[model samples]
Target: MKLVLSPEQRHLREAVRAFLASASPLPKVRDGYDPQVYARLNGELGLSGLIIPEEHSGAGAGMSDLAVALEETGAALLPGPFLATTFAAIALTRVPDKELLTGIAEGRIAATLDGTEVSYDGSAVRGTLAQVLSGMETDVLVAPALTGDGPVMVAVELAGPGVTRTVLETLDITRGQARVVLDGAPARVLGPRPEGGILDRLCVAVAAEQLGVMRASLEAIVGYAKIRVAFGRYIGSYQGVKHKLADMHCKLEQAESIVRYAAWAADESPAELPEAAALAQAYVGRACFEVARDHLLLHGGIGYTWEHDAHLFYKRAKADEVLLGPPRNHRARLAQLLEL
Candidate 1:
């Protein structure tokens, strides 16, 4: 599998990065999402359609391509339904729905996966999800519900009756989250319960986003260090500061490699994806949080203030660390996978 990004991938990354730099600047992100900007991202840039099949009016791209877009978005902290929609799209791939897929690709629908336990009673779905990503903004929810026979995946329209979504306050205010309550909500069964396939893909996708966070945090500190003066010398010149920066850089490098490998495995090496995903989540997850923490610390008192962007990175790091499961949980999974 190709670990290195191809020219096309590089071009896509650059385009995404440049577009985010202009369209989703930090100030814009802090103000919250703009529907127009998101529409441009999906319709003009085609990020939402990156991984959907060409038959569904999507690019029919692979995980690597999606990874590139996610990394750029993570760096920009572009708040909206992009990540949530991507998760829903990925889940939908396992249980194909031409209409949903096309709507997602065309930026006509926003979706997310509900990580709560809901019960499916033959014809209806009932449950209360404490938290759901983009829950307030999404049009559709792909949730796993328990049925009489077993667990099954279902798609429920949020606009329908018997669905209540309450916005929740979270550390990462950049992303919208809500408490979703379903009372016998109408739902369409997708397929049998997803085992490791969906989880692995989610792990890899989040890992890639974490990789971008790590790199951006490192770059921010490094750039700050070059100009910040302390005791008649640049702060970056101090041995202690230099060493810490070097360590962050090392972790960033390792994270990028792991994320790339996981993305590659998802696209071209299906058999190796689970292990690669576990490794990516286990290592990159914790590393990104650490790097984000150091990024705030290295920036001095200013970093702790509400006006600074360092806290944003740190918050995102912490949120992502627990988004799927904590790094410790993934480490345990990795050990089990190896039968160690």
Candidate 2:
């Protein structure tokens, strides 16, 4: 299939790329996502409204359009509450919650998922999520919980009491995670879990990011290999090095195909989105980590140093691998989808 992004989509991707390159360069990204920077990205750039409907004052973009934006963010290593808020929008837009949807479109709320062990006892919600993505500065929390019937999603406004958020010391500090403690917190049930295939759409979003990481790291490694000299010859001139680079390039292309297909399926083919997402994550998750690892290895000793950008990509790749679920988990899901 010939998969080409529309000019408008390409423009959006380029704009985000330029914005992140100048605004949130690799050196400035540290400790955690900058709140001021996030404000500019969402409010000024209108990125938060990309997927929300026009009635909600959003761009009314499709998943394919959102995926392009996500790819650019991943390449730039732009850290913030973008992912969490997008997930929140994905769920809220499915229901008739115009207020929350409008707020999301206008970039008023920062949200993240509390994947901690949430359990509902008919009357109250209780759980302690150890690692919430971008949870420190979140205004709302979209959490999945186990119920008597099955699983359900709840929206808890963090401005209220009964919810405690403790920032965690995570591996990738650029996009910080937090420990969220909910003790009988009052929450609004957004809808049934997986409403409008939010999880699958989310998986596609992240997989698109992994594709960006793969491509970015591959380009970086190849560029370095071309310039770095050893034994009076460029490192890339060596057969072994060239072979590894080729393998990485092949995997990156394979991942791009799956990522694009998954994004398209998110909007056009709901019935196929789950399998598409699972396949993309299963392959791209491992591929991203491997590509970053190889990028580091090919860079030699400096790659292991903290000052190197390779390490940053490496950490993000690792984080993306398990952000939704690890490669193994996605692979298992894929098998289940295939009915194998």
Candidate 3:
């Protein structure tokens, strides 16, 4: 498949890149930027409602467009809860809560999907959902859990009584994650437990973001290699470094192919979506992390220091790889899906 983006999609990516250039440059993230800033921007850009139907106060662009927008955001390392908020928006689309969707589109409310947890009693959830992108400041939490009816997602207000949020000091300072405690908190079940494979859709969306991260990391490293010198010549001139860069480029292209395939499959609901999502996540996760680390090494000691932004992406890549589900989990799923 060519995996060519539509003209509108291309425009969307360019527009988002332009917006981030002016509003959400890397410095903003380095300064411990507030997520509400992007939340408000999302409202203004109508991104919060991109996947929602026009009748529901959304652009109704669908997953592919949203994935393209997120790819640009990841490239810029735009601070805030873009992914988490987007996931929340997806969940809201299934519910009859017009108020919730409108609130999200207008930036009046923040929401996140806690797909990591499987169950929760009133007081606490027994499992750990790590690296919850955009979990820190979201007002609503949508989580899938096992109920008598099967697996279902329930929406809970974070500020409601008996809810506690503890912020985790994470390596990716630009984004935030928090462990939420729900003590008999009131929750509204969004819909019947998803048995027809809704979680697979969510996974593909995450893999799309990983693809963006990998591309950005690859670009950064390649750019740095051309400028940084060793042995009185640019490091990139060395054969050893050239091979590494070649490998990184190849991996990134492979990841791009899989990600685009997964995104397309998600939109069309193809039989290949499950396997594509797994392949994309498994490969992109590891490739992006390795590329980021290699980029750091190319920067020599400077990349290792906090002053340099390389480590920021390095950490984000690692965290994102393991966030929704690690490569190992995805690979296992692929094996099962392929009956291998």
Q: Give the TM-score of candidate 2.
A: 0.93
| lDDT (Cα, tens digit) per residue for candidate 1, span 100-136 | 9999999999999866879999988988898899998
lDDT of candidate 2 over 229-272, digit per residue (tens): 99999999999999999999999999988988998888888888
* Candidate 3 TM-score versus the reference: 0.91
Model 3 lDDT, residue 87, Cα: 81
Output the better candidate (2/3) by TM-score.
Answer: 2
In model 3, where is the ten-residue run with the lowest total lDDT?
122-131
Question: In order, what lDDT does every prediction score?
Answer: 0.91, 0.84, 0.76
Which ranges of candidate 1 are over 4 A from the true structure? none
Task: List the candidates' TM-scores in order.
Answer: 0.98, 0.93, 0.91
Most accurate candidate by TM-score? 1
The prediction achieving the highest lDDT against the true structure is: 1
> C-alpha displacement of 339 in model 1, angstroms?
1.0
